[model samples]
Target chain A: MIDAHAMLGDETYLRLDADELLRRMDAAGVDLAVARPMGAGMVVDHRAGNDLVLKAGPRIRGLATVNPWWGPKALDELARCRDLGAVGLFLDPARQGFFPTEPVATPVLARAAEYGWPVMMKTGAYVYADILALAEVARDFPGTTFVAGFGGFADQWFELPMAMRNAPNLMLDASMMWGAGIQQIVDRHGAGRVLFGSAEPRNRYAVVLKAIERRGLDESSRRAVLHDNAARVFKLEGGRP
Target chain B: MRIIDFHAHLDERWLHKPIPDASHMVAAMDRLGVAQTCVYTMMGFYAETPRNNDLLLERSQRHPDRLIPFVTVDPKEGPAAVDELERCLERPEFRGIKFHPWLQAFAPSMLEETMVAILKVAARTDTPVLFHDGTPPYSTTFQIADLARWVPEAKVFLGHAGLADYVDPAARLLRDVPNLYGCYCGSRPGDLVHLIETAGADKITFGSDFDPGSWELLAERLDNTIEAGLSPEDLEAVLWRNAERTLRPSSR
Candidate 1:
């Protein structure tokens, strides 16, 4: 299985390198994992983290973060990330402290859309990262595939369901979400819009994998969630069961 | 290895809708090889104490070998709460108490008179008290630690190991508070290994916090923990031994 969301490099709170990430993926039976620089890593030096992920080899897919505050420099970094084998883009509105619809973020997103790269945004938390704001961005960038992390969390319980129903361009990762919520999302949005994400080292891969398995999806739907959806959306190569 | 789940909930009143009943829970236990499960009712969160406790009692009685009931008390119900506790504790099947500070809208600090009264009874009864920890203000690690410190005699289990954010602080509290134990519910596999390393396996227990329809998730989480690099002895302690010792102190 491919884990749609994961992080690598040192953070203010934790340090997770490629070796540890690979170890966890192996333990969890994940064939490949997509990772991005964490909040602190992004703030300090996203390029360094992205470079490390690139060097971690093919089993690990890297998503580069471009700070919207960097303006033209942000697009430059996105290009660099693409050269470094990053499959997509990762944005954290809550950590980077910018709204998704801001002019600065719009250009970065638009650049991603121009490349047909999926943009994975941290959502479910309050303020700038809420699902409503994410929906707004998804609506504007219909061509771009937007993945919401944490599946909208506990606080946005009601809002996430509504957001999922309305926003077709928006997909959700099953990280830190309950089994029931994952089932509801599958029932409402179908398996194609749901991706398996572990948020590993922060959350357990088994927890999210189990949530998907517990949904009682038919074999095809299970494959769609476990790897196919993420492989298709992120355009990951060699991510087949 | 034998499995004893320290956290499982009953009642159809969950916000998620269509909660599982006792039969569903038993089927899950049978399938997963969960020899025993400590259960409480979700209804208790919304002040349905008597009705909820009655359902738990009936279910536990019906599936005496599989279901181990943990009587949930609102405490804010004052005398009624104490009476219910006395009533439940009188039964051999009721193993412990489950407190949801966030759900019940009470602080775990035990500053409230009713909380103190409940803790006192718990101490006298020598029953373990599982406090819902993780959320802030009302149910944070420090607040649960305050309750643990206040009632040193009562065996306190911090549910979720103070969640993802407060594992370090929870680890510190576990070292300082002799009565305080960490139960792995909704905790990451890495954190579970960290707790075992930092606080020792003796002070940690395993709990699925399993909702009615999420049995496969529970089994997978257990597998995750096993694969996360615990020794067989440590795995046994976490999966059942620690919980068995805590719930039945005589077993230790």
Candidate 2:
């Protein structure tokens, strides 16, 4: 199964290097983990962290984070990271301190669309990246797939079903969500729009995996969530790991 | 290892989500090696306390060995709350009480009089009270601690042990409040290990906070705690012994 949301390398909160990430993934029975740099890596030095993910090999899928405030430079890095075999782009409106729908972020989303890459946005608890903000951006970029991280959390959970129902381009990552919450999303938007993500090291991958497993989806929907949906969205090859 | 899940729920009405019934819960318990589970109906916290209590009682009676019923009482119901508590506690299957201040929309601290009233009944009947303790404002650790202080005669279990962010405060309260015990459900492995070390294994119990569909998540948390270096003796205490001692004092 592809973990659509994961992070590697040291951060302010937790330190999970690529090797340790792979080791933990093996322990948790996760085949491939899609990772990106978090916190300072996104706000301070994006390349150093993205480079670590890129160099870690195919078992780890890398998503480059670019500060949209960088304007043209951010757009250039978006293409450069994709050229370096990055699966998609990662944006953090909260950590980077920009509204997702701002003109500055527009260029980044436009560039990602141009690269044919899906954009995964951090969307829990942050005012700039809340469910409404994410919905607006997803509506703005029809061609780009926007994965909502943390399934919008409990505080914003009530708003998620409506946001998800309204935006076809928006998908939800099942990290840190309760079993009932995951089932609600699947029932509202179908299993194709839900992807399994483990905000690992901070949250247990096994917990999220179990949340997905408990949803009692049909075999086809379960496969779609655990692997097929991510593979189709991120264009992941080599089937299930 | 033999397991007794301290926290489990019957209804999904709180989230307006559907969950499996008591039969599915027993099936999960059998597969996961959980010998028994203490269950409360989610519908109780919403409203209709007596009805939900009866539902839980009936469900537990059906699977006496696999399920232990915990009645939910809204102290705000005043004298009616006392009646409900007395009625439910009369049953041999009803072992404890469950309170969700946050979901029930009452300030846990402001309900001290009501809490003490409920605790008075609990102490008299030898039933433990498990309060949903986490975050702040309504269900904060300090708020639950205050209730425990008011009714020192009653056995109090802090649900979720203040979750991840409030573990330190929960541990601090656990240190001073002799009657206040900790239930490790939906807590971080590191936090659980630290709590075990700080509060002593006798004061900590295992709780799954088992949502019908998430048994694997509950098992994973248990696995994490085992990996965090809980000793065999300590594991047995947290897994079942402590719960039995607190909820079923005569069982020993």
Candidate 3:
């Protein structure tokens, strides 16, 4: 299975490099994982972490993250990151402390859409990255594939399933969500737009994987969420790099 | 060892599908080997606090052995809230109190007078109070910590243990607040592990946030607890012993 989200960086908070993430993937039965940069890279320096992800080897693909506050610098990083083979763009409003709908993010979002990179936003920060606000941004950039990471976790799903209907470009990852919630979303929206992500180190892969397995989804929806959806969204070939 | 889930809910509005009674909750508990589950009314979170509390009372009365009811109050009701809590405590079936500051849309910071009265009532009765914590502007771990400090005699639980991002703050607060404890409910396994490591295993009780039409939710929470890699003694504390102590403080 392809883990739709994870972080790889040698930062003080969660120092997970390629070997550690790959080791975790092997243990969790994950074939490939989309590795995004975390820590200082998420908020301050984007190039160092993006470089780390680019060199994390085949099993770990890179997701480029930049602080939307970085403005033109963020666009340059996106261009450099795309050329460096980063598979997608990750925007963390919580860490960077910006409302996702801020005009500053528009240029970054537009740049990513221009490259056809799926944009995954770290949600769950109330008004800053509220899922509804992300939905509005998704509507603004209809061509960009937007994955709402954690799907507005910590009690934001109350209206998100319905919100997905209005914005076709908006998708979700099953990280930090209850099993029943993920099941309800898939049942309501179908598994084509939902991807499996463990958010490991912050969350456990094995525990979340077990939660998904025991939910009793049909094999088709299960495969779509666990592998196929991520492959399609992140543009992985054969569920791997 | 018996497992007692300290947090579950009984409100059809949030259940998605129809559930005629508490049998589904009991059946799910039985299948998972959970001995008892403390149930609160989720509908009370949105509206009809007393009516939903009565509904929970009736449901708990039906399966006295398997379901433990926690009463809810719109503390904004002031004296009426205290009276309702006192009335509910008249029956031993109601073991604790549940509050959802975020969902109930009443921050304890804003309703200080009502909160003080309710906390005093819980303290006098030796009843544990569980707060749906981990959200901001209302139910952050620090905000709950203030309540715990306000009524140091009362047993206050951070119901979700700071959920996704607040676990660290919850753990930090647990270190300073003697009356404050955590429920291993909504926070992920890694956060739970950190809570256990930083605050000690004795500070937390296992909670599934389980409700009807969500049996798999219980299983997933159980997986989270087990995945935290607690030793048998620590697991026992989180799964049941800590909850038992909190439920019946006399036993402690």
- lDDT accuracy of residue B164 in candidate 2: 43
Which one wins on DockQ?
A: 3
Tens digit of per-residue lDDT, candidate 2, span B1-252 = 888889888774556668776787887777778898898888788888888888778867788877888888888877778888888777777888899888888885666677778999999888989988874458877888888888889999898886744677787788789999999876655566668777888888898877565566566656545655678999999998998888844331
In order of appearance, the predictions have TM-scores of 0.86, 0.77, 0.94
> Candidate 1: what's its TM-score on chain B?
0.93
Q: Total clashing residue pairs per candidate?
A: 0, 0, 0
The best candidate by lDDT is: 3
- Better candidate number, 1 or 2, judged by TM-score: 1
Residues A92-145, candidate 2: write the lDDT tens digits: 787788888788888888888888888888776546767789899899889889
Report how far residue A144 has shifted in candidate 1, in Å.
2.7
Model 3 error, position B83 (Å) = 1.6
Better of 1 and 3 by DockQ: 3
Each candidate's DockQ: 0.37, 0.15, 0.64
Give the lDDT ranking, best first: 3, 1, 2
lDDT of 3 by residue, B104-207 (tens): 88889888888888999899888999998888879888899998888899999999998867878898888779999999897777787778888888999999
TM-score of chain A, all candidates: 0.95, 0.96, 0.95
